[model samples]
Target: MKFIISVDCEGPACVVGNAGKALSASRDYNFACREATLEANAAARALFDSGAREVWIWDSHGQGLNLCIDQLDKRCKLILGKGFTCRFPGLDNSFSGVVMIGYHAMEGTKNAILAHTYSSESYKNIRVNGQTVGEIALDGAVAGEFDVPVIFVSSDDKGCREALTFMPWLETVVTKQGMGRNCALSKHPHMVQEEIYSGVLKAVNCIHQTKPLKFKSPVQLEIDFKAVSQAVKALVYRRRGWRLVGPRTITKKIESMREWIC
Candidate 1:
């Protein structure tokens, strides 16, 4: 068996700052990335224990290059670069399962750790048919396109809740409970790692029982931005329910996955 692990920063044990916008390396963004990688490694170890012969990790954080590779489990291969159309790269229909690590809340989440969907400069919130979704959901939809299943996800309380809404049976490890988007009560890194290991093992062992992660066809995606000009750019796709949110943002909602464009 083979598994693909997608790792993101900002929702691990103690993440709190925006990507790159963090004031210093000591900021939550950087700290979160390292912690996120540890979680990924734990999951990879569990995958191996569950009969997975190979586990590939996709570094899906800011700039698509956040995971610390050398410290990762030697049993896995890490994909760290910004070369894919989607953040999750080199993933195809062949993998037995997919796991998301250190994912945060969707854009506009209230009191959720480091919340932002795609780009903060790009959007204030992103909704699909009026429902909020995070990076995990969009990436999972891409995986669903190929008939792959998202078996596990790791993040804070909000992120885990988001995943459960889409894929109820998938396993999750919540490392933090946010007091706000930038403030959260987190477990120690060691405890977080323990949960990651156990969660991944359970996910892989029960992969068959875990349902696939999918969205309704003709998916309606609303992209709300922080600027009006950005919303104007979406005018071209108006036929798909794209609209401007006053003079400061854009919103689009489609019901079918006629095409995946981002």
Candidate 2:
């Protein structure tokens, strides 16, 4: 089997804050990235041990360059950088399953560490068919388009719960319990990696039972920006199906998840 591990910087036990801090070149930022690298590599190693033919790691954090590439599992291929034309770039029907590591909750999730949907500075919320969703749901839907199920996920308590709502059969590891957006009671990095390794092994064993996360046809996609200026700037998308539903909100109706996301 083949697998892809979509890794985000926040919600991992080793990271207390969001990837936005990495932009400032902080020491803690590098440390968090290194720890997340170890966790991701752990998952990759587990997949390889579980008879995986291939494993790809996507640095799905800010700027898509946060992971410590030198430390990643040597057998795994890395997908880095940004400016992709679509969501989950390079992902296709060829892959078997997706593993989300260090994911977070949506913008308004209570007691969720570093919580935001896509962007902390811009988006207020993102909804699919009137239901608010975070990266967990959005990414899962994108993988679903390829018939790939998100088999495993590791995050803070709220984040793991959020993943469960979308994929109840999923194997999850909670790295922390969120006290607030920037505060969490986290497990040790070693413990988090151990759980991630074991969780991936279990997920692989039950891959046949898990189902891809799919939404009904004709999806309604909505974006609520944090500022009116952001919405004004996004008005250019109006020609591409976006409509100004409010001063800081845009809505679009599409025939499939692929239309809005792919």
Candidate 3:
């Protein structure tokens, strides 16, 4: 068996907003990266112990270079950099299952720590088939296109709830409880990592029962930009299958999640 672990930097006791903070190595950002790496290491080690032949860890946070590479479990290969057409780069039908760690909820989610769909600055809300979705749903649907199920996830309490709302059978661990966009009551890092290790083992054991998170074909994707200027900028070079539906919104029709473009 083989597995992929997607690690984002905002949920494992992290509250930073953008890539600049991560690049600058601010105290909070550095701590967030270390915590995320520890959690990823735990998940990777769990997958390896559970009979996975290959484990790939993807640093999926802002700038796509958030995790501490050297500190990760050497047993698994790391995926770095970003700007690929596919959300989860190198993801294909060959992987057995997907695991997400240190993820938050969608933009404008009440009391979700550092919540945003894809970009905190650019997007106000992203809806697929008329339901608001976070990275968990969007990325999960992308995996679903390849028949791969997201078996495990770790995030804040609200983020876990969002994941459950999308896929009730997903195994989740809550690393913190959100008090506001930048405030969270976090658990001890050691505790969260331990839970992630065990939760991953359980999730992989029940992988056969979990289903891929797929949306019906010809999906209606609606994106509400944070500002009208952002939407206007998008309309300047409108691509195929995209339309300006409102002053701050753009709509698109896609046959699959893999076709998500705007």
Candidate 4:
């Protein structure tokens, strides 16, 4: 079987502060990248050992280049760089299941480590079908378009719980429990990696029991921007069904996963 693993940073395992100082190119970014890569490598190795014929690792974090390519498991093909239209690039119906690693809670989640939707600077919150969502839910919905179930996820305690609301059958590994936005009681990096390895094995073993999560067609996406200026900027896409709902919010009706990502 084949699987696609989508890796992000800023979960309990990483993320030291706000977006500017915590993302790529910053002084502290390397630490996050190292941790993320370790977790991804662990998952890949586990999937391979469990008889997965092929594995695709997509670096879904900042700049889409955060994973340490040299340290990643050589058995898996890695998707790096940016400019891809799909949120989870190279994903399709061919994969047996999807796995999300190093994810966090949705925007406005109290005590969730570095919580935010797509952009911490631009978006304050994102709602699909009137329910707040994070990257996990968004990407999971995209996977649903291809009839692929998201079988595994690793994140903070809250993030895992949040994800369960949308995908109750998902196999989750909680790397930490958040004390505050930038503080969490995290397991050692080595320990977290070990859990991820085991988690992936269990997920793949039970992949057939999980089912894809699909939202109703003509999905309504409501975006609340952090500032009015950000809302104004997004309003430029008004012609594409983006309408101003409030001074700092906009809403759009997307017909398909392709439109949601684009």
lDDT of 2 by residue, 60-118 (tens): 88889889888887899989998786677788999999999988888889998888888
Q: Which of candidates 1 and 2 is the stronger one according to lDDT? A: 2
What are the per-model C-alpha RMSD values against the true structure? 3.1, 1.9, 2.2, 1.8
Q: Candidate 4, which segments miss by more than 4 Å at Cα?
A: 12-15, 18-20, 25-27
Pairs of residues clashing in candidate 2: none
- 1 versus 4: better TM-score goes to: 4
lDDT of 1 by residue, 134-247 (tens): 787887877877677899988889888988888888899889998886678889899999989998888878888866566776676677767777777767645555666677
Q: Any residue pairs clashing in model 3, and if so which? A: none
Off by over 4 Å in 1: 18-26, 234-262
Clash count for candidate 1 is 12
Q: After superposition, how far is residue 199 of candidate 1 from its true place, in Å?
A: 1.0
Candidate 4 residues 102-215, lDDT tens each?
A: 998888888888787877777888888898888888999999999999999999998999999999999999998888877788888898999999988998888888999899
Candidate 4 shows a clash count of 0
Off by over 4 Å in 2: 18-27
> Candidate 2 local accuracy as lDDT?
0.86
lDDT agreement with native, every candidate: 0.77, 0.86, 0.86, 0.85
Q: In candidate 1, where is summed lDDT lowest over 10 consecutive residues?
A: 18-27
**Which of candidates 2 and 4 reaches a greater lDDT?**
2
